[model samples]
Target: MAKRATVADVAALAKVSSATVSNVIGNRSGKVSTRTRQRVLEAISALNYTYNENAATLRSNKSNIIGLVIHDLSNPYYTELIAKINRQLAKKGYATILACSDENLESQQSYLHLMQRHNALAVLLCPTWDTSGEHLAAWHDLSPTITFLRPVGSHESDFIGIDNYQAAYDLTRQLIADGHRQLAFIGGSQSSRLRRQRLQGWKDAHEDAGISWNDAHILYCSSSMSAGSAAVMQLFQQTSDVTALVCYQDIVAFGAMNALHYMGKTVGGEIAVTGFDGLSDAEGWLPSLTTAEVQIAVLAEHIVDRLLARLEKPQEPPSVTLLHAHIHWRASSHGDVDSSHAR
Candidate 1:
């Protein structure tokens, strides 16, 4: 048999130090340049060298693995975010292990335990509504964890998410400017802090415009297409005066539009519809959706940055990073606003 290739052989062939070769193989932070990394990779491929990951884990007490625990993988919002996150992590030679909670607390806790067993270096979590501070603290003991999208109580570890209240407030304010007086907020459970922040934004917009927001118009439901459709149906059945529907997400907005079409109401003409989370398919709808554009790629980058930072400095103070989101006005929300307010 041919002699097995070693790290020394790779370093000699790549014309770099053994330490540089090790850094490239382990994805450790160093001053290795792109040119050197490429040469090391080429040498690795040419030599068909394989590092024993299990032995490495034992020696270093860490794995080249990151756990991603999220709610509702079925939602496009999360799927898009994961795509960006996967790309960014791969560049650093790390692999991701994904777990879906379906918004169930037991399932989420179980998945966290599984990640701990696998010895993941850290976790990026989008926690469920019922996930308590105590549960999160326990998970933090297993690994460095960062919460995203959905936030837990104050005592939870570091969090990275958009400014939900400001984004929602801006969208609502624009709809009001378009002469929508009788509005309805749809799709979100009352128990969620995210939902509450968004709801507060809508309420604030109404108050600023000197319009009374009716409690009857605030409909609390699951953030889904079916729920949005059902809620819109109920709203119309009660009264046809709701001229605009502000949905918690683009999927819910799609459902609302479908219901409106079935009811023979013309979206963007007879009644306006707006949504949050600027999804990829938003622009493809009959009358493109008006939504708050959360930069998924940017958000993913920030999330990875924070998670890695936590891993390096585990003793650092826990902090929150809130990114901004902007509203994109399209045909769905009537498209009649001044050109300056389009985005």
Candidate 2:
């Protein structure tokens, strides 16, 4: 059996230093002379050499693999986000290792550990509801991490996410302008920071409008269609005064819309419904959903650029970025006002 080709063999065959061979193979900027690169290429072609990424990672303690750990993959929001980030990473010559934590804190930690073992370049996380500052500290200790959507409690690292509070405020104010006096917030648990940010925005809107709000109006449930439908029944059971709903997710809004139909109630006319994460499906439904569009392409660009920049400039100070989501005021949230908000 023939021994496998290594960088050492390539360097020896090409009469160049091993570092020169590595620079040529890695396409290191302005490092390898063209003459030397040509020689290394010829030697590699002659030997049929294949660079071993795993071995290179072991030696340099750096990897071209990026980690994506999200709390829920069941939500289309996360699925689409994964797709966008994966595409962006692939374009930059990095591979993505995705893990769904199912919103479990323990599972999330386990995946972070797995990524650390693989020496992942960095981990982009949508933190679990119960994720704490200590968790962020420990994970940061292990690898470069950027938390998104729901920022971690601890000021452990950088974050890039939509401006949940502002977007919710804008949406809620719009609902108020449309004459929705009684509004309900549905989906997501109390433990989620992102949910709290959104809820605060909703509550502040009511306060600013001189309208009374209460805790009963905030429904805590899993971010799913079933939970959404159940939340509607649960809200009506408590009091049917809720004139509108502000869902934690678009999926939940979809469920609420379905539930409203089953209850023989008109969705937009009787009880306006609004959703977060302006998913593509939200735009094409029978009554197009009014939602805060997260703009996946823009978010993915931020995530990937942050990751690549971190790899190149590890010493730079970490920062948090928040971009406002575009509000699509469609027929679903059609209230008393003239529907000027585009579908």
What's the lDDT for all of these models? 0.88, 0.87
**On residues 111-177, what C-alpha lDDT tens digit does candidate 1 reach at each position?**
9999988889999999998987888887787788899988887645999988999988888887888
Residues 1-343, model 2: lDDT tens digits: 8999998999999999999998999899799888889999999999999989888899888888989999888888888988999998898898989999988899999999999888888899988878887887876876789888777766667789889999999999888888877889999887778888999999999899888887898898888899999998888889977788999999999999998988887888888999999899998976899999879989988988888787787778888889889999899988553243221
Candidate 2 matches the true fold with a TM-score of: 0.89
TM-score, each model? 0.86, 0.89
Model 1 residue 205 distance off true place after TM-score fit, in angstroms: 1.2
Please give the range of 10 consecutive residues that has the lowest summed lDDT in model 2.
334-343
Q: What is the lDDT of residue 145 in candidate 2?
A: 90
How far is 103's C-alpha from truth in model 1 (Å)? 1.2
Q: Show model 1 residue runs off by greater than 4 Å.
A: 1-48, 335-343
